[model samples]
Target: IPFGFYLFLKTENYIVGWIATLLTGLMVLYAVYTKSLAAWVSISVEAIVFISILIYLVKTGKYQFKIKSRLYALVLTFTGFLLLINIDSGGFNLKFGGLSDQVTSVQEFVQSKSSSGVDVVRSDAAVKGQSSIEWRWSVWLNSMAMIKDNPLIGVGAGNYKIEYPLYNHKVVRDTKFNLESQLDRAHNDYIQAAAEFGITGFVIALWAVVCFYYILFCLFKSDLSDLPGKKLLLAAALMSAGTGMLFNAGFSFPFQRAIPPFIVMLIFAIACVMHAQKIKTSHTSIIDTRLLYAVTFVFTLLFFYIGHYHYTMIKADKYFGRTIRCYNNGNWPQLLNEADKALSYNAGRKRVLFYKGFASNELGKIKESIQYYEELIQYFPNYINGLLNLGIAYGKVGENAKAVETFKKIIVLMPDEGGYYSDAGHYLTKLGKLDQAYTYLKKGAELEKENAIILLNFGVLCMQMKKYSEARKVLKKVAELEPDWDQPKQYLKYIKEQT
Candidate 1:
């Protein structure tokens, strides 16, 4: 991406442009360290295409350069960078593997490295069917089945994650490898959009993509000779990046990222401006001083208008991050203090409220915890974690009624989840609603039949209800499930005495 930007700048300032190579080299090293196959592929493809364009321009006499000097400069800069990296790392060696190695993907490369001196031969077909890739395909396929149910309106926002678990059981049932975990993202933005918002999201995404390419088309089909030197390079560079991004989006969720979309649109906007200027057929420069100033002013105005809000948001995020760190470190007092500071900046932020509640509860300030939880639930009633935590907090405070009510709502949201039913049942037992509690406990045990904790709770509930025979049977099963657990033996002995 930095290399692409360098190409864009090369048109205006050839000397200044080579400096971007420093950024380019560092980014490549970063990609290698991170093992980001997507970043590597994006950079590689862009470099190949952009370099090809440069070669074409020079050969066809459209552009000229001191090729030898530029090549030598590039080599020296990269070599120096690598030397520094090696020195800093105390032996950061890079090697070009034999042609026979032919590592195709980051997964393959990692596999090869982990089993050093072993050849990891992967067939072309197995490349996509590899565990990481295959399960994504399975998810996409399963997600489609779900979308077919209500194609037009979708399952709705926040419903996808809760609801998808039901449809994705087929993949989970696979014995060889249950490669699926969270279906939070389908990893394909287009499909994810369709899954979340239905056909409406798919159409909007498709249209935006089409319009994006149309701008690129306008810029590409223009008389390359007519546009200034840098403008031509700029268009080609943007085209490479935009095309690379489109490809990456198919495999990953770059659209969900913070920077990629903005970069894509920024380049797209530039293309549109260049295309419009061409259609005008004015001999005036494609990017004149007036246009630059206009863009500068508009961006400046926007920053001034939106800057304060972003500053506050950044501040809130930092504090929230610190609160999480505090929570992780088990520093409850600091967590409450940090979370409070964050809430002061963004009082309505759901996570800040949740964390504050969590800290307060951990600090034994139950009333304060309830207040923070109530605030979170007030703003985000359907936030599952907030609701779950709030419900747990209620139980901690002996507000069994509120806890049972909250768990009931959770059961409605996640009916198939045994944990929610267990929560509801546990609270109902506390409230002395024995019959209703039994129904929930039975259902929870049925859903998660092998869940020892829920089964033990159910056994305890049966004992409480004085159904001695049923209690003995349930307690025996719990003993089998947890052979060493003393509670089941004690409960069985008590049940024996009762009988």
Candidate 2:
């Protein structure tokens, strides 16, 4: 697509940025996953090149307007209406859309979660009227922190989740801020690359983008003028192709789809056809058997590898997701077994680590649980589950100071995550940091006042602080929120009797 984009740069800005980006996005969606730096660099460069071309075209008055006939306009209008309906239709809420069948199990999990009182608002909810954006943002921030600590070699590809907790432990140890289960990749491409492949991979990825832009523009200026509409064909193909990739890349994983292969095939086909035409026009040799054979061999190999790779990833992703289901269902043994199976195929998988860590915790192997959680935090620090669990494990081990520090790290990684704040407060209260405990609990309560656990934690803090009136109010709320919880009910009763 990048190569194609440069080819269209000389013809029109409309052909370059907007159109090329859309094409690039579509290709990316077909074959690759964008959770890495390579994909980002590719998209960013194509977008930048297109925008530059657009500006130049606008400045030079070289932009050609394409007028639509009435029939064409009507077709476009109908297509637009159909697309709008598709976008707004609640036919399927799955991200995979038509591919939803392949992920029926995931859809089931989503359905169950929706029924479990979890709002999609988690996507944009404030932890406690604080910036939930910032909370999500912390994943990026902490990921960078991890890269800086181990810049040259990286903690290891897929090691951020494992290393993050150590950094968190070093910085703030009060709350659980595990990264193992909460992330599949670094939310940002640049950060993920630096963490996984170090500075070298980051630089190479950027360089590839630079090369793409140069090639795209060169192709655009190549003279096919004497051949009439030949130039337009080339321009449309490249522009349309690049645009698809860039647009799809903006929000979803385009790289993991078959998009890349199709885009590449389009480019290769254009190059071959154009070269053959140029040779024929020049009265060159009738046939080039060597080049033909090479192209055939290349296509065969590329398709073969692509097919195999796609299937492998599909299988791995499914089993990985199933491991999560096992954990959620409290099938500890199954979780452990499935995690091992997943790791055997794709070792150090962050999601698999979550199952391993949680299952270990459930099985009373605190040391083993901590081991997996710690490893996950180091490699995938952006994830929060491991950190949360690690803090809980520390609490279980009676390492109050370590527990407090862990929770504090969670605050840094996701300050608005009310649950982290609540957990931190609970541990801080245990550590006799009464003032800090009060501050955190109060803040957490404000975020999710309807939360029975948060209110109960606050009531416990108030009781310890000798603020009996505040304690009474908080415990009353706790009782209302969880009438079945004997702890809140008993505490409230004792307070009333004393009064």
Query: All models: lDDT?
Result: 0.72, 0.62
Q: Please name the candidate that would achieve the greatest TM-score relative to the true structure.
A: 1
Residue 468 in model 2: lDDT: 82
Per-candidate TM equals 0.68, 0.53
317-399 per-residue lDDT for model 1 (tens digits): 99999998998899988988898788777875665887788788888898888898888777656556767888988998799
Model 2, range 1-499, lDDT digits (tens) per residue? Answer: 5554444343344434444444533554432332333344455565565565555444544444332222343344445434433342466233432333324544554554467473323332322332222333445556666778777877776565455544543322212243333344544555666777778777886675455444555544444442324343454445445554644443333533565646655664664455444343554673989998999999999999999877777777777887989977999988888777777766635658867888998899998998898888776665566678889999999987888888887787666568888988888888888999999999999887899888888988888787889999989888888878899878877788877
Which residues of candidate 2, in runs, are more than 4 Å off? 1-228, 256-258, 261-330, 364-366, 433-435, 468-499
RMSD (Å) per prediction = 8.0, 11.7
| Cα TM-score of candidate 1 | 0.68
Q: Largest lDDT belongs to which candidate?
A: 1
